[model samples]
Target: MATLIVEVDDNKLKMVKDVLKAMGVSVDKKSIKPEKAPNETTALAIKDARNGKVTKVESIDVLFKSI
Candidate 1:
């Protein structure tokens, strides 16, 4: 098992989660909560992605299993 922290647009969270689930990955929403808590950071980020606010995303963290 491992943890993947993706800094994706707010609206894309659902899609990302679904994709991860489909890929057989265990995702923990509460663990990888966004940085701008309680705000529309994720939503705004998604909007920005749609409106070309940013060419690419800021950053993402992924924890891999040591094996």
Candidate 2:
């Protein structure tokens, strides 16, 4: 037995599940709700973003490099 988590696009999600089902796979379904309010640091970050305190990135390379 194996378990995995996958993130899929909303538009393609049903097609993906249907294909897996047709292939004789069990798609044990569950939807986990997001936790409330986030953590303290995450809350602060969200607050900052809402307040327009973020820096604008000029290049995609710079964004990826920073991460």
User: Candidate 1 on 1-67: residue-level lDDT in tens?
Assistant: 3223356567677876786688787865533346646346555655666775554424432212221
After superposition, candidate 1 runs with Cα above 4 Å error: 31-67
Cα lDDT of candidate 1 equals 0.53
Q: What lDDT would each prediction earn against the true structure?
A: 0.53, 0.55
- For model 1 the local lDDT of residue 67 reads 14
**Tens digit per residue, CA lDDT, model 2, 1-67:** 4332344556756875786678676865434339664666556655665676755454434533664
Candidate 2 vs. true structure, TM-score: 0.42
Q: Which is the leading candidate under lDDT?
A: 2
Off by over 4 Å in 2: 36-67
Candidate 1, residue 18: lDDT? 80
